[model samples]
Target: MLGRLFLKLEFKKVDYAELYLWLGSLMKNNCKQRRQFLVMAAGLLAASVVPAWAAGVSGEVKALEGVAWRNDQPLKLGDPIMLGDHLRTGADSKLVVRLGGDVYLLRANGSLQLENKGLVLGSLRLLSGALLAVFAKSNKQIITPTVTAGIRGTGLYVEASEQSTYFCLCYGEVELMPMHQRSQQFRFKANHHKAHTLDAKGGVEKSPLRNHNDDELAILEALAGRKPHALVG
Candidate 1:
């Protein structure tokens, strides 16, 4: 009877040991599952925060020769950018821009200021020199020294000089408005050119001009230190 009691006690101890081991294993598995769940939750939270941080214009900016300044510093290609900003290109430096399916080839010796107020399409103020603007579906405007070209979905070329400003439409129509006198406006058709001659009183000559190769010729003349031939003489 004594031997049987001792054996029964040993068996009870063995069962308790097994139960304790099983409990330990279950606790370890639970802890691992909880850790995995926490990791997955953190990954999802990071993914949700990315798109809200990227609502502005971002693109590559390349300078051919001189420096290109953004926010008063030099700009680099493939760097992220925003609007309502001023950029100054170094002397004899060209700027190449790519943003939202639009490409702008900016000639050397120029400055551009962008104004994007969300509702209104962005506006560009060209301080000087020439720029070839190619637009997508959106309308683009170029505010020159003496004229403003309201471009409708097309490619256009603009050149500025001390005496006047020139606009040559290659693909679409551009409404030219003299800034000095807001009432005087003209529509320049595709394959047509117009010149806004500046006078003492900020007045412009309203004349229809002709220049077939003015777009190509302006680039050449700008490089050669000569004023391009005026189409609307």
Candidate 2:
């Protein structure tokens, strides 16, 4: 009877050990499943957050001495910008601005009024002085300017003075019309430049001229707020 009782006790111990091992395996599998579920949930959350951060204007503006206005507030470098602000450069002051995706170089005593929200849109009014516009290929808009020249998907040099507006196409096509007569359109190709003069009856006269490298120099000067010869090589 004693031997039988001892054998029974050993059998019970063996059964308990097997049961404990089985429970341990089940717990480990459950923990692994929970870990994998948490990892997938974190990945999904990160994917949803990426697009929310990339939908605003990403550009810069440098003021030599004047002030730029955006959303009825003064604009500065590293400041977030919105649409419908007037950018005015004071006399002898220069501005380098990037809107949407285009780079604009405004020379001394120049002003550009923004019309749309993106990098390029609506109308830009060149009150005076010069502006060089370099547009990205993805931008497609009819940039109309009063007393200035317009370029589409290309780089061009625009200079406005008291006399008239001069436009030289450095790399792409340009459209010109008198500020008063928006109906008439004139297209100028690359390697060509033209000047438009307004007459008494709101008529426009065009004169062709030789292209010069002065436009690039003017752009560099405007961006650096000094003479081009001093900065450019």
Candidate 3:
């Protein structure tokens, strides 16, 4: 019974998660412009619950280079990220967002949605290009075009495109499951192990870890209030 319940809960309609994220921030309170905010965020109450979270504060804007856009606005260095923020980076651009228990590196030509339930990260959807991250022990989900992985205290990298997605769990554990086919789930635990495709049925075989490095993990870990297991003297 317990096993069945777990499996049932694992199957989430992640495609609609983005839609909810886009409209999730409508629920807020104690605003100076309460009437105006409510007008824009009217129907968001059903999507998001009330919580006491720091407004417009998702993470510390550590560094950025080249040009980037946040929700279509020019992304500044010290801008605090709000929930449902759509982040996009252009050529030669780079961005680092340090969140609670996690840090994200968004490489050039990438886009993603920051989705959280009341300041707790629920789903982080990497739309395109490269995204590198190290997560602390927390309930977070990583989503790409073809793959969705449940992450907890994990180090991972993803490069997503319309054709396919490149995924590698650098350290710790991740549950590799397909968005279309949730039955063929694979749980992986290791350092520098790669799972390129979505599933075994006509899916590409696992490849050796490539691209990402341990030092990168160490850097993100430092910002996330932890030390990377790979870092050694």
lDDT of 3: 0.65
Q: Tens digits of per-residue lDDT for model 2 on 1-233?
A: 32442353334422222222232344445655433323332333223321211546544563333554554466665465445666666565555665654556676656666677354465566656677666655433333343334555566666665555666665567666666676766776763344554432345666564333433433323232232221234
List model 3 lDDT by residue over 132-209, tens digit each.
898868878888877788989888888887667678888789887776677767788877555565542326467666
Candidate 1 stretches with Cα past 4 Å from truth are: 1-57, 119-121, 161-163, 192-233
Q: lDDT of each model, Cα atoms only?
A: 0.53, 0.49, 0.65
Give the best candidate by TM-score.
3
Which sections of candidate 3 miss by over 4 Å? 1-56, 199-202
Error of 3 at 201 (Å): 7.5
Q: Model 1, range 1-233, lDDT digits (tens) per residue?
A: 32442353334422222222232344445655433323332333223222211436454452234567777878765455566667667776666654554556667777777777584447778877777665655677888777777876565666666557766666557787777777877776654444445442356555444332333333222222223222223
Q: After superposition, how far is residue 107 of candidate 1 from its true place, in Å?
A: 1.6
Candidate 3: clashing residue pairs, number? 0
Ranking by TM-score: 3, 1, 2
